[model samples]
Target chain A: MIALYTALITGAIMAGLQAASAAPPGGEFPSKVPVPADNPMTPRKIHLGKQLYFDPRLSLSGDVSCDTCHNVAGNGSDGLPLSFGVLGRVDRPRHAPTVFNSAFNTVQFWDGRAKSLEDQAKGPLLNPIEMGMPSSGAIVKRLAGIPGYRREFARVFGGKTPITFEHVVQAIATYERTLVTPDSPYDRYLKGDKNALDKSAKQGMHEVSDLGCASCHAGAMFDNPGLPMGTGWFRKFPMIPTNPTCATYVREYHLADDPGRFDVTHKQSDEHVFKVPSLRNVAVLAPYFQNGSVGSLRTAVRVMAACQLGKTLTGLQTTNIVAFLNSLTGKFPVETMPHLPETPDSTSMMQVAKLQQNQRQLN
Target chain B: MIALYTALITGAIMAGLQAASAAPPGGEFPSKVPVPADNPMTPRKIHLGKQLYFDPRLSLSGDVSCDTCHNVAGNGSDGLPLSFGVLGRVDRPRHAPTVFNSAFNTVQFWDGRAKSLEDQAKGPLLNPIEMGMPSSGAIVKRLAGIPGYRREFARVFGGKTPITFEHVVQAIATYERTLVTPDSPYDRYLKGDKNALDKSAKQGMHEVSDLGCASCHAGAMFDNPGLPMGTGWFRKFPMIPTNPTCATYVREYHLADDPGRFDVTHKQSDEHVFKVPSLRNVAVLAPYFQNGSVGSLRTAVRVMAACQLGKTLTGLQTTNIVAFLNSLTGKFPVETMPHLPETPDSTSMMQVAKLQQNQRQLN
Candidate 1:
């Protein structure tokens, strides 16, 4: 029995390796960032964004920030299925995805709701349950009231009355672009250092291609297959749900709980179709899928095989796929936590009427 | 009328300056940290503690870390009346104090319940409403399961079964000791750079002395007049609450809400008694007082004078004191955000029985 298992695994590894060698593998992440012509990257703007990203003053509760949900400090995720928002509201619809390498995505968010990173930045701040600002104007007003922020906006953006909702999102998205992590072991292996991956990981890397996982998770980001920016390469999760294995897993995890992209587009064809989430750093960002129902990466791998590909994975296959996914974990950039700029001796909370702010916002 | 007001202000400044000039001024923060003999400072332990500080896995909700409430990136205090804890519990009775310079604090917490920083570190993580670990054993179990944390703990605290709750707090407290912010404009002034503080700030400094604010807010930290470490300087918040003005203000702000130290000590004398909190970075830490009732620093200063000293200040006194407090806002040290350690292909959340963790924890 042991000899039969080893022979089958070896045959699978050889077949997978043959498929991987058919192409030059043009999935290397672009070293140069594609800057929006209107908004060039600047040190001052990045610095401004860092402060705004960490500042809770953006939230109505003054407890949540951009970092609260999409925390760049960790794996760019808060690790919860749905992050708690202002006043501790835990009704956030989806698991917060990692902000790392979000720039490489053709579109931001699971549903591909926002076309660009800048548009995605504004959604949570006004989401009532998320950052919970009443309106974009209210957020802008709070930023403008602070003299330091006002000066920073003017300096970074360089215009009369520059502390706009537009500028805030631009700065934040620009800062987020700097959050991409590179230099994973997978990249080293791709760069011709064969010894970068131990035996099992190499087998898993080839199996990922053989199992058709790379069709969606294609490229250095594992998000797109040479698509233009804003053109999301989306695919239906649980693509082969009619298969008995797929149907059984779907019913168990409630894979149909969310309508996915159908909610965004209100199109029947878009139902259950979600953006191909980057497999980069997927090992650390567990509790997988749209609903974050899956916790272990191995289970996610097994579920993907049975539900999406309609193949029941053997124990060896499951272990190997998990190993390859683990190789996606990359070196994170060191970031200095910012000292959020404060108005001297006063705060935006103080600007509100006396006991009303305490009643409305505080405990 | 203007001349008369100016003359009075000049006289007050001169009197305050006379009091300040009388002493050698022993309030400058000590340049070196006084490490406890048992938990000597090391780069490795500090590094380990930092990972623990930023890791949300320590929290039952997998959201709140040490940095969530006491965010070192901003003013150590989360600028809210009470910080929202794990699962967004906002029932925290008192405002979270700034973690900056907390090492110099005689005792931790508003009521001085914890005797040392190490003792205080364990409080929030286990508090049902705060970080909300089920128990110390559960937290230790969670940490031990993470291989990266296990290796780090073993390296930092050299013994078998190194991942103890005790060592966790020790490392955190040791890291907290390094959180001290030293060179503010006030510190620079104390270092004989008279010009570091502008003219208005200088006048405010002197008035702080004249108003007897220096009596309690004494020395470099403005916490105590040389109390030995571990001995808290307790004082009645509304020292002269019987004063009609003080009584009226108290009723409006609900200053008598929580029976401060009495809850811990259960002694009549300890009723409404709180540790004299350090005024190190008081300028940025707004929404002042125990309940965070007063939003403006001017209002807080006025309330302190009326409630504590039975003195009503002129407008100029409030403005000048606010300026002086602004000078206390110190230079924050740069901190790099950490990548929390993740187990190879598993997580503590996964170890919990399947869908039960999702039911208990996530949305």
Candidate 2:
């Protein structure tokens, strides 16, 4: 009887620990992301990807690079309503979403246009309105011309074509996967840190679960890349059977207009439903929603409530939800970008050239 | 006699070892600066100084500050025939001298008018043509209003009351003195570092002593504050006794016209002579004469040779001398200026009302 009682007590204690640590229904996320077989994650690829992400020379203007939009200093997104790209000061059509925990998305892009980060990476580089490199060939030639880059490319890519668009995309994707949002107050509170989150955040999180936001955004990686042991393939996130919120999209499954995954797959059932975004550091990233219709977090919650739960949240409840969203923010590494060489063939060069020109004019 | 020979051999070997370990004569400097006493270096302060140095807040029209002409990043002097101050484009009459070793000077300003750095600090703040604050009292009142500055000022210079002009000057002076040059190749060579300098720098340094440049520019803190142990109390620098090549002024005991020392004493014999400027980093500091009549190091050397030595430097010799001047470019401690509050209600408010007004209009 004593041994049996001890066993029962130990089981109860383990359950209690689980209750404390498990994401309070809403904050639960996937454990891992699905990676394509061709471009496997490697240390070399990650290193190269990090370098490419920071190199401003990748852009045609050499100024409005990826860093201009997704500033590491300002929690991924540049805290702007929409990004300013290439030569134009005019705002972009969509908000620059945070790349903090994007790896586990069932599909990338607000429209669910791309299947993987590798697929997503290629879209931006070729989006003439973005980096505005004339052509991939031109970019390759330019990179090849830089002797340091030529040597580095050879070392990283294992004698593969040093200047291919595919290699570039693969490297960038590898780097993106490494950018996981680590332990936040939400995670810590789950992991026995009772005081990690305040009353407001905890209350907001409970509301988030009640509203069924966790149905689509679930587990460690947030979005469902699909059932781990069952099917390895990518599907529209928030599997309909599991999430009642997904039922709304089921009626419009047959509709042909930008049928989210159906466009990529041609399957009638895979329609309209898109990957849910991670809420990590979501408080700081402004201009919410796929079309950036919602500017404030409170408004975003209300819209989601109306769309997903078919219920309107009170103003105080919305404020609490926003506070919870803020609690999900993760600590970021504070490393600086490498001191890249100041090329004489650029701004300083032009200044020097102008001086020379003025001298000629004087003579 | 045997012991003396052994000592000489050991000294020679140590000197050789030092020369082998030394760094190259001159190159680019490190991005960050070191801090010193009465002023602990911090990123916030340095950032503030960088902004202030670049900012026109100190000017009447918000178009000029200390950095308007004396560009700190560009070897602490503007590369111009003469520096501009009041008006954005108006060039000031005299060549803005390099501020590299100004901290070590016994007296400051072109005429040796200021006794100490503390005395020299407020001159530009209220100089109608320079920073142009109305009065010392106005500046203090302005600073007293800024809330952010109040805390910083209290911490940096004790409680706010009697936070007079002296604190302002002292803080700035403290910041300036810490701008000591880093270990140069020569310094390393002295310390027994091999390969610290190249063959050219070594050959050039030998020529530096031969050309009599060291007469005025002497010791680690180059410009002689006053060689009390050597010559009389004070002597005009770069001007040797009995130099017939001096075309502008003649001196029996002292130059009669400029009367460098006489300006203070009204002694006609002490006229037309100025304290010699330091030649450390002279290669980078252009517009080299007191009046900035000479533009380059080579030109300055030639002018000095003709005037002081009654000998004209050959083209190669002038090049060699400039190379030697290049050798003197030592490592300087780069410090970040602590951020003092700029707001009117802050503890350490800077007196920049006109600048604030201009900024508001721009915004």
User: What is the per-residue lDDT of model 2 for residues A273-338, given as tens digits with 9 covering 90 to 100?
Assistant: 554676666765655644333445665676567556666678889978887888887666543333
Clash pairs detected, candidate 1: B27-B219, B27-B220
TM-score of 1: 0.90
* Quality of candidate 1 docking, DockQ: 0.33
Cα lDDT tens digits for candidate 1, A37-85: 6677899999999899889889887778898878776678876666677
Best by TM-score: 1
**Recovered native contacts in candidate 1, as a fraction?**
0.45
On a 0 to 100 scale, what is the lDDT of residue A75 in model 1? 77
Fraction of true A-B contacts recovered by candidate 2: 0.00
B32-124 in candidate 1: lDDT tens per residue? Answer: 655667787899999998898878878887778898888887778876666777656654358789888888787789999997888999999
Interface RMSD of each: 4.6, 11.8
Off by over 4 Å in 2: A1-23, A26-45, A158-161, A225-275, A291-295, A341-363, B1-191, B197-363
